[model samples]
Target: MNKFIVVTGGTKGIGLAILQKFAQQGFDVATCSRSQKDLDTLKSELEKQHSCNVIVVKADMSKRNDIKVFSDAVIKLNRPVDVLVNNAGYFAQGQICTEPEGTLENTMEANVYSAYYMTRELVSLMKKNKKGHIFNMCSVASIKAYPSGASYGISKFALLGFSKVLREELKKYGIRVTAVMPGATRTASWEKSDLPEDRFMKSEDIADLVYASHALSDKSVVEEIVIRPQLGDI
Candidate 1:
């Protein structure tokens, strides 16, 4: 069977870059996002460009029900997943004391709970097959404290913690887990900033690293990957 990958929030940014990269390498891919229109468009473009089967689903990862909805669709595929990239996430700038109420809650629902619940559903297939890789899209905020980075930082830190625990738990099963901490990526999240584009890392750069990490022989795995802009964090 062809290699299969599932990347969440593939409508744009690093997720989109990942989808394009893997599709070009002949991996049949699946992805989900909040917007059906965008998903449909991505499906068409990747299918046309790479001629690989593309599965698209409309899913708001922040919601548990939607995570199941997307997971069920993948389970129904009846094929073992070769890779899973938990890329869907939320980001907002705020101070813990002054940030809007529920900021931490909402961000956790997106960046942490979604991956937790989604991974719960799919790891079984990997266990059955005895091989798979999972990538959690963490952030530099996970390790550094910055002004106005409250909720997003907390959520990413929790995500990194989750990834570490998962790495330990799944190691015996031959399922590799990687926590990806990226800094100042030039995605929609940074579009509002006035900083020069060169200051941030390209989404494709992360994508390349993610795919490369998975391409290693099954005997080895990269536990964590930290990427930053050439000029450093913005």
Candidate 2:
């Protein structure tokens, strides 16, 4: 049985980069996206390009039912899950004071609840063998407050805190959990930004760190990683 990795929201951005990186290393990948078309395309591309199993499921991570749908897809594979990236998230820039009602609730549902539900379903699989690594895609917003970024920042902060508690609980199980807090990265999310492409880090930069962290010795686990653009937050 080949070791496999699972990633959510893996059709684009940092999630896509991480999926490709793992596939390149000969790991079978199971990932999810909301777009069935994108998932099919990604499955074909990765299988053809990397010569590995590419299981792509259509899932809306914010919903527990949908998370179960994705989890069932992966669990049926019956492969050892070596790494799981809870990368599905939503980003909306809005001030806490003036933002519409349920702004924070919506953001938290996507960024925090989604990861929580997905992990609850999959961690048991990892626990079965007492092995695996889990990465939560946090943000620099988790540690710093910025204007018009309240919902995102608050959700990210809660996510980081969740990762911390998960790490503590899973330590004895030999399942490592890491919080990845990255600064601005060039992705579709920033298509409208006026900043130069060089101003923000590339998705691959964050992907590289994720791969490296998982490659470390089983006895050595990175608890948290914070990376930023050279010029700093934009």
Candidate 3:
């Protein structure tokens, strides 16, 4: 059977990079996003470029029902997903005290809650096969505190911890979990920040890392990989 991968936020940025890599390798790619138009366009572009099967679903990861629907669609398309990448997330910029009342909660819902829901649903599918790989797209903020980023950073921190605990819990099932912490990727979202694009890491770099890490023998796994721009110190 062909390898299958399910990626959240797979239409753009780091998620898009990962999806392209897998598609180029001929993996059956299934991805979800909140925009149907973007998903359809992405599906066509990727399918044309890679000549691989692509499944696109409109889903808001923050909604539990949407998460369940997306997961069910993926499983129905491919019985066993060889890999799951939780890359859908939101970045809310502001101080906790000054931001909107529910900003932090919304950030947590996107970054933390979505990861929990995706993993919960996919892990059950993996359990049936006793094998799978999961990659959580964490951030450098997951490790350090930054000014005016209380909510976003905290959410990533929660996801980092979740990834670690899950690695330990799912070890017995032969399912590998990896937390990919990337620093300063030059995505459209980063344009709002003051970071210089030329000097920072790119989404393709993270995509390459994902492919390489998953290529390792089943006996070993890299639980966490923290990547940073060589010019930037974290």
RMSD of every candidate to native, in Å, equals 0.7, 0.8, 1.3
Give candidate 2's error at residue 209 in angstroms: 0.7
Candidate 2 residue-wise lDDT, 1-234, digit = tens? 567999999999999999999999888999998899999999999989997988989989888889999999988877778999999997898998899999998889889999998899889989998999999999998899987788999999999999999999999999999999999999888888999877899999899999999999999999999999999989
RMSD of 3: 1.3
Top-down TM-score ranking:
1, 2, 3
Instruction: Name the weakest run of 10 consecutive residues (lDDT summed) in model 1.
Output: 189-198
lDDT tens digits by residue: candidate 3, 1-234: 668999999999999999999989889899999999999999999988987889999999999999999988986764788999999997778987798899888998888899999999889889899999999999989998886688999899999999999999999999999999988888877777675566788799999999999989999999999999989742
Structure candidate 2, residue pairs in collision = none
* lDDT of the candidates, in the order given: 0.94, 0.92, 0.90
Which parts of model 1 have CA positions greater than 4 angstroms off? none
Model 3, TM vs. native: 0.96
Best by lDDT: 1
The order of the candidates by lDDT, greatest first, is 1, 2, 3
Residue 38 in model 1: shift from native, Å?
A: 0.3
Please, what is the TM-score per model? Answer: 0.99, 0.98, 0.96
Considering only N, C-alpha and C atoms within 3 Å, which residue pairs clash in candidate 3? none
**lDDT, model 1:** 0.94
